[model samples]
Target: MFGDLMGMMGKLKETQEKVEATKKRLDTVLIDEQSTDGLLKVTITANRSIKSLKIDDALLEDKEQLEDYLILTLNKAIEKATEINETEIAAVAKDGMPNIPGMDLFK
Candidate 1:
């Protein structure tokens, strides 16, 4: 019984390592979003770190419009990044999980 417990513990440790690695990898995964009018463009990592922002000169003419565009575009970018991040992390975690009796019920 102890042997089985030890093996399960080891598997859990391995899964944790894989999950951390996957998170690091996600930092390089980029998600790009642009405003509907194509006036503002944003690039962000799956980790939700902003990589770059490109704005059209037209947007600079109005402060309020620029803020609105920025908010909308950034929100879209964040949403996409969050989805990718969660899916990737979940896939890694689920694949690494060791099969245990009754665990399938949670799925």
Candidate 2:
């Protein structure tokens, strides 16, 4: 019984380490998305931090259209980042952790 408990603890520690490493990898991932017309672009990290934004000079003349395009472009970048984050996190969970009852519900 003691040996089994020790083994389980060891596995838990290793899994924690893997999770941390995976998160670091995720943080470094960058997702870039742009508007359909290519007038606006946004770059974001997998952790949902904005890295940079680019706007076409032509769009600057119209504040309303520029704002609308910016909002749309930003949302696309964030959505891509979220999709990648979810996939990476799910893979990490599946690979590093043991299956538990009711865990599928969360996934």
Each candidate: what lDDT?
A: 0.93, 0.84
Using all chains and alpha carbons, the TM-scores for the candidates as numbered come to 0.94, 0.84
Give the clashing pairs for model 1: none
Off by over 4 Å in 1: none
Task: List ranges where model 2 is wrong by over 4 Å.
Answer: 99-107
Residues 43-72, candidate 1, lDDT per residue (tens digit)?
999999999999999989999999999999
RMSD of 1: 1.2
- Candidate 2 lDDT at 7 equals 78
What shift in Å separates residue 103 of candidate 2 from its native position after superposition? 5.7
lDDT for each residue of candidate 2 in 14-100, tens digit (9 for 90 to 100):
878887887889889999899999988888999899999899999999999999998888988888899998888777767766554
Q: What TM-score number comes out for model 1?
A: 0.94
